[model samples]
Target chain A: MLQFSFWDILSNLLIATQWTIVLSLIAFVCGGVVGLILLFMRVSGVTPLEWFTKGYIEFFQGTPLLMQLFLFFFGIALFGVEVSPWMAATLALTFWTSAFLTEIWRGCVDSIPKGQWEASSSLALTYIEQMRYVILPQASRIAVAPTVGFSVQVVKGTALASIIGFVELTKAGTMLNNATFRPFLVYSLVALIYFCLCYPLSWGAKKLEGRLNVAR
Target chain B: MTYKLQFAELLPYWDVLLQGLIFTIILTLVSTAAGIAVGTAGASLRTFGPKWAGAIVTTYVELIRNTPFIVQLFFIFFGLPAAGVMLSETTAAFLAMTINLGAYSTEIIRAGIQAVPKGHVDAGVSLAMTKWEVLRHIILNQAFRKIYPALSSQIIIVMLGSAVVSQISAQDLTYAANFVASRNFRNFEVYLLAALAYLLLAMLTRSLLRGLGRVIFKAK
Candidate 1:
C-alpha cells in the first residue's frame, strides 16, 4: 500500500497544469493564424471566398466542440492515423478557436469605416498593401480586448481534452481525486486554478472594452 | 486499407438515439427557461439592488464564466456528494447548464438593460409608476428586445455545450453515440451521425428561440 499527502497531490496537479497552458497556447497561436486567413477571405470582397469562409464558420460554430473532438479522435483512426490524445486535443481546439476568432476579427475589420478601404485603394494600393497599411492596424486595436477575452475560452476548452485522456489540469484533478477519494477538495482547487487563469483576462477585457467605448 | 462506414449497425440503435435526443432537448429547454429567469434577476440585482446583493451576484457570475462547464458539472456531480449533496446525473446537468447560461445571459441582459435610455425610466417614474413597474414595463421590455439576438446565441451555445453531460452517462445524444460506437466499434460513423444530429439540433434551437423571442419581445 502507498500513501500520498496533500503536497504530493498539489505538486503533481501543478505539473499537469503546464500541459494545460501549453495546449491553450497551441490553440491560441495557431487559431489566430488560421482565423486571420479566414477573416481576410471573408472581408476581401470576393464572393466565393466569402461564402466559403462563411460556411466554414457556421459549421464549426453551430456544433459542439466535444463532438468535433470525438469525430477527429476517432475519424482519423478510421484513416489509419492513430492520433495521440495530444494531437487530437490540439486539432479540435485549434479549429474551434479559429471559428470564434474569425468571427470576432471579421467584426473588427468590418467596423473600420468604408472610407479606409476607399482611401487606401484610391492611392492605388494593392489589396494586401491596403489592408496592411490602412485597415488591419486599426482593426487589431479593436481586436485586442476580445481576442484576449476569447483566450480564456480556449483555456477552459482544454479541460475537455481530459475526456479523451489528455493529462491536463482537469484530468490530473480527477486522477488525484480517485487516489485520495476527496472529490470536494480536489475539484475546488481545480476550479480555483482555472479561475485564476481566466478571471484576469475577463477583467482585462471588461476594462479594455470600457476604455474603447470611452475613446468613441 | 479499405475502411468503410457501417451506418447499418447504428440503425438498430435508433431508439436509444431518439431517447437521448429527447433527453437532451428536455435538459436544454428546462435549463434555458430557468437560466434566463436567474439571469434576469441577477442583472436586476447587479444593476439596482443593494450593494451586498450586487457583490454576491458579481461573484457568482465571475465564478461561472471563468471556469469550464465540464469542470463545474464534475464538481457538482462528483464533488457535492462529499458534502452531503448528491444529485442525479440529469439534475446535475440541468443545474450546471442553467448556471452556465445564467452567468453568460446575465452579462448579455445587463448590457441590454444598460442600453436603455435613462430618460425612459425617468419618464415611467414621473408617470406615477413604482420602481418595479418601471423596471418591468419600461426598462425590461426594451432591454429584452435590444438583447434578443445576443441572448438567444448564448442559449444555443449552452445547448450545444450540453453534449458534455454524456461523459457522466446522463444519457444525452452523445451518450447514445458513445454506446453505439463502443458496441459496434463504428466510432467514426456513430460520432459523425451524432455531429449531424447536433448540427440539426442547433439550427432548430436557433430558429425556435428566435420565434420565441418574437412572441415575447415583439422583435421584428
Candidate 2:
C-alpha cells in the first residue's frame, strides 16, 4: 500500500484549486456579458423585453444553484447530448451569475436620475448613444464595487460543480478524504482554500465601496 | 433514441418528495428561528459589546461568509466525528445552516442597528430605561423594522442554499430528487420537479416572511 503524505494531499488540492479559479473566471466573464444584455433588456423600456428579463431573473434567483446544475447536467441528456460536468457547471453558473448581475446592475442604472436620460434624449441621442456615452459610464462606476463583491459568490458557486463531478477544489478534497480517511484535516483545508480565494475579493469590494461612498 | 420527459413517472414517489420537502421546511424554520436569535445576539455584541468579543464575532462572520455552506456542512458532519463532536446528518445540516444564516443575518442586522440614530438610544437612556430595555424596545425593534426586507431576502437565500445539504444524505428535497432519479432513471424530470418545488417553496416562504414581518412590526 502506498501511504500518502500530507504534502501529497496539499499539493493535489492546490492543483485542483486552479480549476476552481478558472471556472470562476469563465462564469464571471460569460455571465457578465449575458447579464449586461439582460440588464439592457430590463431597462430597455420595451414592455415585452422587460417582462421577459424579469421572468428570467425571477426563475434563476428563486431556485437553488444545485437544482440548476442538476438540470443542466441531466436535462441535456434528454436530447441525448453528452454533457460533461464542466460544461454543465459552466452553463448553470453562467445563467445563475447573469441573473444576479442583471439585477445588481438594474439597481445601479435605476439610481441614475431620469434627468440624465432626458438630457441625453434632448441632445438627440438615440437609445444606444445615450446608454453608451452617458448612462453606462456613470452606472458602471457605481457598479464596480458590487460587481467585485458578486465575484465572491461566483467563486463560491463553483463549489457546486463538484456535485456534478467537476473535480474542482471541493471534489478534490472529497477524493483525498476518501483516500486518507482524514475528513477533519481535508475539509478544514478545503474551507480554508475557499476562504483564501474569496476573502481578498470581499476585502477589495469593501474597500472599493468605502472609496465610492466617500467620493459620493 | 429520443428521450421524452415523463414527469408523471414521479407520481409514485410523490410522498418521498413531500417528506423531503417537509424536512427541508422544518430545517429552514428551526434554523431560521435559531439563526435569527444568534444573529441578533451577534449583531448586538458587535455593536455594543466589548472589543475582544466583537473581534471574535467578526472573525466568525467572515469565516462563515467566505466559505461554501457545503464545506461547512461536511466539516460539521464528517470532520467533527474525528474530533469527538459527533453529530447526525440532520443535526449537522441544522448546525451548518444556522451558522451560515447567522453570519449573514448578523451582517444584515448590524447594518440595521448601525443605521439606528444615536439620539434614539440616548433618549431611551435619558428616560432612565435600563440597558436591556433600551436594546429591546428602542434599538432592536427599529432595527428589525428597517432591515425586514433584507432579512427576508437573506432567509430565502439560505433556504435555497439549504438544497445542498442533500449531499450528506440529510433527506432534503434534493435528496428525494436524487433518490427518485436513481431509481427511475428519469433524472431530468425528477430534478425538474425538484427545482419547481424549490421555486414554489421560495416564493411561498418569501410571502410568508413578509406577512410575518407585517404582524410583528405592525405596532409602530
Candidate 3:
C-alpha cells in the first residue's frame, strides 16, 4: 500500500472540492430557473396551478433528500437506463433545491400586501404586467437574503450526492481516511473545509438581512 | 415503458421496517427534548451571560450551524474513536443530532428572545424576581410562543435528517430500507417505500408538534 502524505491527502481533498463547487453552481442555477417558474405558477391566481405547485413542493420537502438521491440513482437503473452518478446527483439536487427555493420566494411574494395586487389590476394590468411592474420587484429584494441562505443549504445538499459516488468533498474525505488511516485529521479537515465554504454565506445572509431591515 | 415495479417483493420485511420506524421516532423524540433544553440554555446564556460565556455559546452555534450534519456525525462516530473516545454507533448518532438541533434552536430562540421588549424583562427583575426566574417564567414562555412555528419546522427537519444516521448502521428507517433492498435485490421498491415512510413521518411529526405547541403555549 502506498503512503499518502498529509499534504497529498489535503491537496487531493481540495481538488475534489472543485466538483462540489461545480455541482452546487449547477444545482443552484438550474433550480433557480425552475423555482422561478414554479413561483410564477404558484402565484398565478389559478387554483389548479397553485395546488399542483404546492403538492410538488410538499412531496420534495416532506421527504429526506437521501432517499430522493437513492430513488433517482437506483430507480432509473431499474428501468434499464444507466445513469451516471453525476447525472443522478444533479437531477435530485435540482428538484430538491427548486422545491425549497419556490417556497422561500413564495413567502417573499406573499408578504406583499393584497392592495398592491388590486391596485395593479385596477390599472388594467395583466397578471404578468402586475408582477413585472409592482410585485416581484419588491419581493425579490426580500428574497435575496433567503436565497443566499438557501444557497448554503444547497451547498450542504451537494454533500449528500457523495453518497451516490459523486467524488465531492465529503466523499473525498472518506476515501482519504481509508487511504491514510487518519480519520480524525481527515474528517476534521473535511468539516473545516465545509465550514469555510458555508460561514461566509451565513455571514453574508445576516448582513443582507441587517441592511435590508434598515432600508425598510 | 412497461417496466415492472415490484414493491410486493419487499412486503415480507414489514417487521424490520416497523423496528426501524420505531427507532427513528425514538431518536427524534429523545433528541428533540434534549436539544430544546440545550438550546434554551444556550440562548439564555448567550443573551444574558458574561462576555466569555456568550463567546462560547456563539462558537458552539456557529460551529454546528455552518457544518453539514453528516460531517458532524462522522466526526463524532469515526473521528472521536480515533482520538481515544469510543462510542457506540447509536450514542454517537444521538449526540451528534442533539448538538446539531440545539445550535439551530439556539438561533431560533435567540431571535424570539430579542423580539421581546427589554422593558418587560427589566420590570420583572425590578419586581424582585431573580434573573433566572425572569428568563424562565417571563421570557421563555413568550419567546417560545413567538418562535413556535419555526421551531416546529426545525423539529421535522431534524427528523427527516435522521435518515442520514443510517450511514453509521443505526438501524433507522433508511438502514432497514437498505437492508431489505440488498437482501431482496429490490433497491427501487425498498427506497420508494422508505421515502414514502419518511413523508408520512414528516407529516405526522409536524402535526404532532403543532398540537403539542397548542397545548403547551395555549393559542395566540
Candidate achieving the largest lDDT: 2
Error of 2 at A33 (Å): 0.5
| lDDT-best of 1 and 2 | 2
RMSD of each: 1.4, 1.0, 1.2
Tens-digit lDDT track of model 1 for B191-212:
8888889899989888998888
For model 3 chain B, give the 10-residue run with minimal summed lDDT. B1-10
After superposition, which runs of candidate 1 have C-alpha atoms over 4 Å from their true positions?
none
* Residue B156 CA displacement from its true place in model 2, Å: 0.3
Shift of residue A14 alpha carbon in model 3, Å: 0.4
The superposed Cα distance between candidate 3 and the true structure at residue B80, in angstroms, equals 0.4
Tens digits of per-residue lDDT for model 3, A110-157: 999999999999999999999899999999999999999999999988
Q: What is the Å distance of residue A108 in model 1 from its true position?
A: 0.8
Q: For candidate 1, write residues A1-216 as lDDT tens digits.
A: 667787888888889999999999999999999998888898889999999998888888988899989887987787888799999999999999999999999999989999999999999999999889899999998999999999999999999999999999999999999999999989998999999989999999989988998997
Query: Once superposed on the true structure, which residue ranges of model 3 sit more than 4 Å away at CA?
Result: none
| Per-candidate interface DockQ score | 0.83, 0.83, 0.80
TM-score of each: 0.97, 0.99, 0.98
Clashing pairs in model 2?
none
